[model samples]
Target: MTTDDPATDRTDREDFPDWLRQLERDIRPGPAVRLRIWCRRRSRRLMGAVGVLLVLALVAGAAAYGSGHLRRPGPAAHPAAGPAATASPTAAPGPFAGTPAAGWPAGAAGIVLPAAHRTGDFSTAQVSAGLAQVRAALLTARLDRAFMAGRSPDPLLRHFAPAARASVRKEYATETIATYATRLAPDARLAPDPPRVSGRITYQATRDNDGARKLAVTTNFVWVYGFRDPGARSGYSVVLLHDTVVWHLPYPDDVAAASRGLWLHRTSSYGWGLDCGTIHQGLVRPGGLDPAAAPFPEDPEALYDPDHPIAVPTHC
Candidate 1:
């Protein structure tokens, strides 16, 4: 007792407060050990919460990426809905608009002319009216005076080649009905009773050449002049001339070889009328002549000297 042993005395000491003693007894090892265990439990709970938040963030990111990829235009894409979806304005009317009359003339099938013909056989009255209209249109600018006068005017001058229009205008200051007649080659006649006033005209036209191929075509036209009044004078005349113009279809080889020199001729009540005459000639290249030309005037009044040949290219 007189000599205290430090280790044993410390272990057996009871000098601390009752609360401290109780606390020490409550902890299994020491206060520091208890603090370390509490801290580890808290750290595990915090880590679990952080993991849950990270998982939620990843899921949200994936959904956002998928949504953007699906919503992303090109040829394969559907066309946008707009005014372009409507039908074109120039489409032809239905078949009900005009039907061929029953019991059409012999050699005439429906409103269309048949292929092949006898020597005496010629175009029907319907076809003739169409030709007349075409002639008048071609001669419009060239026969203003003749139109004003009461004479049957030449129709070619009005519908000359678009290129020749300027030249004709320059040469013939004022187109006269007499000038129109002058341009004709003498033998031409109007078909007595042209086809009916309404409906399309179709015909099988063959070329003048022996080996020429025939073709079928339908044409529609508007006539600016009507049947002239025998007694009345001074009125704007108008009529509807619709018919088919069937002409021989040139063979591919002939068309290729002949270039612009090919043309078709027809005999009319008035005179010999040449068609496809105004076509330009030259190589098939830039600045070349067009293969389809205007009809040449055979009337003496409208004729150009062959020897001197009008400056206009009349190769055909």
Candidate 2:
């Protein structure tokens, strides 16, 4: 027993030294040092994450600011602040401005030619007198060379306004009367009778700024010519032609209905033919010619009537 006791005591003492050394090492702070190192590493990682989040927040704020500025309202947002709020400029009165007085018609028809055959202020008889002067002028040109030698002496020529006179002068000056006569057949010559004429004249009665009456007339004529050239071996030849004349008078309504009638029907294309009838139906209506009345017919085969010869000399 004594021998075994001694062996056990020695073994126990040896084990105790190793165990004490291990305990001392554990309590010395090595565990605490490892834990402190781990905490420092984790703190650095968290700080890095916070820094990234702050950078993202700054970028997002800049984008939002730019977007807001771009969406601002423009000048059109307030209409009252725009050009619409300004007053519009007015236009000046025209030459023919102002409403006509009471009882005056709306257009020229009422102001120029009120009645079917009457003009402004002038009686039908007075208009006829003026028109007779025009017819005389036309007839004189055919019958007498002296009348055609210079400007027409008829009072009707004086009635024309300056513009109308200029126009007539220009037209007549440029016209080749010699050429026109030469185009006729060698046997052609002036007829013995005057041309039969018919038609209407339209006149304008406008007052100028100085209160002077101004007149503008349009005449249409249907002329029938009976050729009486002695050289014609085929007997008497007849032809028809049309003419239109426009003139101005110093006074209003100084044109006659008969003259106007003669002017309108004077042109061969518009006189005593189907075309003339068509024009009459269209032009002479409620305000023009009597629609109920029949138009004069034209015989396609007949050249002229023995009783009603209307031809005049063309050459001097």
Candidate 3:
């Protein structure tokens, strides 16, 4: 439908792009929330695109809570006083709430990033599902090894909308396995392997969004990189057992889909985010943590230590 179509205007579709662009510039992590954390640095333009899409998803979700097929509920007579009188009570979902999608990440408890209060106007499930889509998109960004090898980040990037796809593709076009390997070892190189990941993500659904539930999702991941440990002190040391940080990545065997599988974003947008509570044993030293041995140029803070920071989820 053209911008002239009334139906298009109803969903704010015509205005969504403008609204989205503004939100991207303004969105920030709430209390104890992490923002702009990516493990490996990536193209800012690509990440900006990803951020826009993520927030847009949340913006759309705010409406998902309407009780009747996007229908707003009628007002109640003589509403109760105080919190009890509010349209959304903690105990009761509001007229417009949503449900979580199937197989989305859950159970990573007490990790909610504190921020503006939500009026129970939405279904916790639906908000989570919306967040899951973002996570799926992130997972695709992290796990789809094809992108790093100068291949299409499909199936992985598929989670993203069409517009997002265009942005990611451009970034991939500029990358190559040799570029990363060269960065890791200028003289003595380290072989690259798929990075493994695990962690909890939390959300803060905000009061903004003009009756929609614009929200932000925070990710805390533990990544373990595997490589052909070239037992050389000059390069990455075999300190953790084989010149690499010996840690187990979090791809669960039961997870059947590549989209949901645990992995880190190669670019420094999503995969690198960490908070105090997420450190874990076998996790590489933060000072030394970077993508594709990209940290090689910098001095490592510490080698892989089993006793190093092991992330513990913060929100109870």
Candidate 4:
């Protein structure tokens, strides 16, 4: 059976092994059906990866939304300031008919506030004008002898909000300002140079009664008073006065509307000290007398006067 029949013997030997031929057949794609089957196997893994990414993206979006980073452009917040209680929307073309100051908005516990509005960035242009108005008011209140000689201090009342006008009126009635006024007699006058910004002041957000966002501003007034002390041993007494005046400004959304809502906000409970400074007794007299050294509260700029205190008595 193992004879020398070359052709038959070669076929029996098999040049390509059975296993190698079968491997080639398996490697080659047979049809579209087989290719579809192969793709379906990997598609599950690919789909699972996409699904995981989608879940992560959804989570991130939810977090951003909760944190207010992804807030949508929605209707603006409408805050009903105290005036709304008295104001009738039907009476006016708008909610607040004439102007914001018509009734003068109030906050909780009768805290006087500007009209209900947004807060501001307080740029130089916006803040400078406000600064000027307040500065002039401050000068008139504590200084300006000629203006207050016999005239009513009511002129200064225009600058203060209606709610606080009475309280501050009492403050000017006290003897502190009176004493300061008399000391600068014989053509002595108190002069205020332009106000210069002193130091760091914080800007914090607040919610108005109507839920409108507002900004609280901390401001320092470095008031330098130039006076002629005709009676003093020294020639001229320059008083370096400092006080922290706090107010609020409305936030502006549009560039055109910037600072339109800007104003000062103050409540007796939340306002800063009217006078907080290193007491320099006399400008001409260096290392001058200390106001605290006086047996009585003798500081001219003190909020409380020893001889004449607030209408409602407060222990100094």
- CA lDDT of every candidate: 0.33, 0.39, 0.34, 0.41
In model 4, the Cα lDDT at residue 271 comes to 9
Q: Single out the weakest 10-residue window by summed lDDT for candidate 4.
A: 277-286
Instruction: Name the top TM-score candidate.
Output: 4
TM-score of 3: 0.32
Compute the lDDT for candidate 1: 0.33
Worst ten in a row by lDDT for model 2: 280-289
Each candidate structure's count of clashing pairs: 35, 25, 28, 8
lDDT of 4 by residue, 99-160 (tens): 22123221111121223223354455545544455555545644444544434657666665
Q: Global CA lDDT of candidate 4, please?
A: 0.41
Query: lDDT winner among the candidates?
Result: 4
**Alpha carbon lDDT of residue 100, candidate 3?**
16
Please state the error at residue 308 of candidate 2 in Å: 20
* Selected candidate, larger lDDT, 3 vs 4: 4
RMSD of each candidate?
20.5, 26.0, 44.8, 26.3
Per-residue accuracy of model 2 over 176-291 as CA lDDT, tens digit each: 22111111222334344443434445665555466645444554444443444344344334344344554334453443432222221122122221122223222110012246
Model 1: per-residue lDDT, tens digit, 193-255?
222222233445445455544333333321112222222232111122122222232333434
